[model samples]
Target: MSLTRLLFTAAASVAVLAAVPAGAHADTGPYRMPPPPFGSPDAPGADRLTVSVVDSGNGNDGTYELECGPAGGSHPDPRAACGRLDELAAAGQDPFAPVPAGTYCTMQYGGSATAHVTGTWHGRSVDASYKLTDGCEISRWNRLTPVLPATAP
Candidate 1:
């Protein structure tokens, strides 16, 4: 091609490249934009929970994704689970609060089941685990029943 034409093309290409956003070349995997912060005014679908239960002895184990604020997910009963969570939040208590100090707990062994719950509730993060080892722990585990798979009696 002519020298002038080549020079014009090269300059135009450089200008176009400089106009592009720096993030345009970033490789942030699937999500191009960072996920919205939970409870942020601009965040949608931020109130959600992922729950998992494991009971090797009883063969009762499953994982469920539960959403609140509108109460939707693969959970068996989103409404009930959300209601329970709302109750806990309304009372300003953590659903997975440790056995209170000086509280009496029976010495009976409950069972061999473990559960994990992680998600956002009331815009706050929740990463809790439950095990049925003692009376108090059993009760805590029971409170999240249905959200976490219920152990066979």
Candidate 2:
């Protein structure tokens, strides 16, 4: 092949390689989301709030999915929560993990029972606090919200 042709081919190959997806060249390593937070209010007949942790893959950039509901009731899906986590991750913020460590929820159920959640990412943890009120209000269980870093005591 002519020297000019070889050079052009090599440059084209380099550009193609560079355009490949990052995961294709990246090392396939295990990425984990933080554990769920603790704490729940009293309920009737096993009516306890539960939080679940989901691994959203490396695409989430160390974000997590937190789903919660009544202990005996069906739990909410983690996709919405995962989406929220992705947004936070994109903003260069780790919302799933908090500094001090703990689960937090910002849900306000118009009932007597409340649920709280906390998630961890990259060794950090974040929390949300939930409070129940009256009526049948929809509690923010599967939605992703801002997770504030806990202040040092």
Candidate 3:
């Protein structure tokens, strides 16, 4: 299988694994969104972000809310996303850094999916875009797996 397919499969797996049970019932009407697994309203400098992805070519689009310092959000895998960010912070790496030039990549057209993440995290503002237009971009996109949907909307 191709690397792109492998990355997609891994992301899909994460999403499925992180899914929470819906507590909806007839008495409650629509399902009440679950409280976050971590973090609290009173916590100082709690992280919050609004993430979105749009692929006009393939009609994949979605927007979700993300809060960390205790992962919680509409994001499919909040814990993983937050963990990635934390790892970057720990290593002094920039999550939004441009993929290095001349990096070897296959000439594969994964998709035209484009995603953007905005909001605050780790006490800093975030405004980032992700795409799968080429190998380097695909690598970057994969790093954000499960945060952005793997399939077209």
Top-TM-score candidate index:
1
lDDT of 3 at 136: 79
Q: Name the better of 1 and 3 by lDDT.
A: 1
Ranking by TM-score: 1, 3, 2
The residue-by-residue lDDT of candidate 3 on 51-76, one tens digit each, is: 88887354447788988868998887
State, as a TM-score between 0 and 1, how close model 2 is to the true structure.
0.27
The digit string of per-residue lDDT tens for model 1 on 1-153 reads: 999999999999999999997668757456567654433445443678988877735555678899987889988789998887767656656675667899888887877788888887765678898887888887887776656666766
Q: Model 1: runs farther than 4 Å from truth?
A: 1-45, 56-60, 100-104
Better of 1 and 2 by TM-score: 1
- The predictions' CA RMSDs to the true structure, in order, are 11.5, 17.0, 24.7
Weakest 10 consecutive residues, lDDT, candidate 2?
A: 39-48
Q: Against the unseen true structure, what C-alpha lDDT does each candidate score? A: 0.75, 0.38, 0.72
lDDT of 2 by residue, 58-113 (tens): 12222223432311223343444444555655565534332233435444443333
Pairs clashing in candidate 3? none
TM-score against native, each model: 0.62, 0.27, 0.58
Point out the higher-scoring one by TM-score: 2 or 3: 3
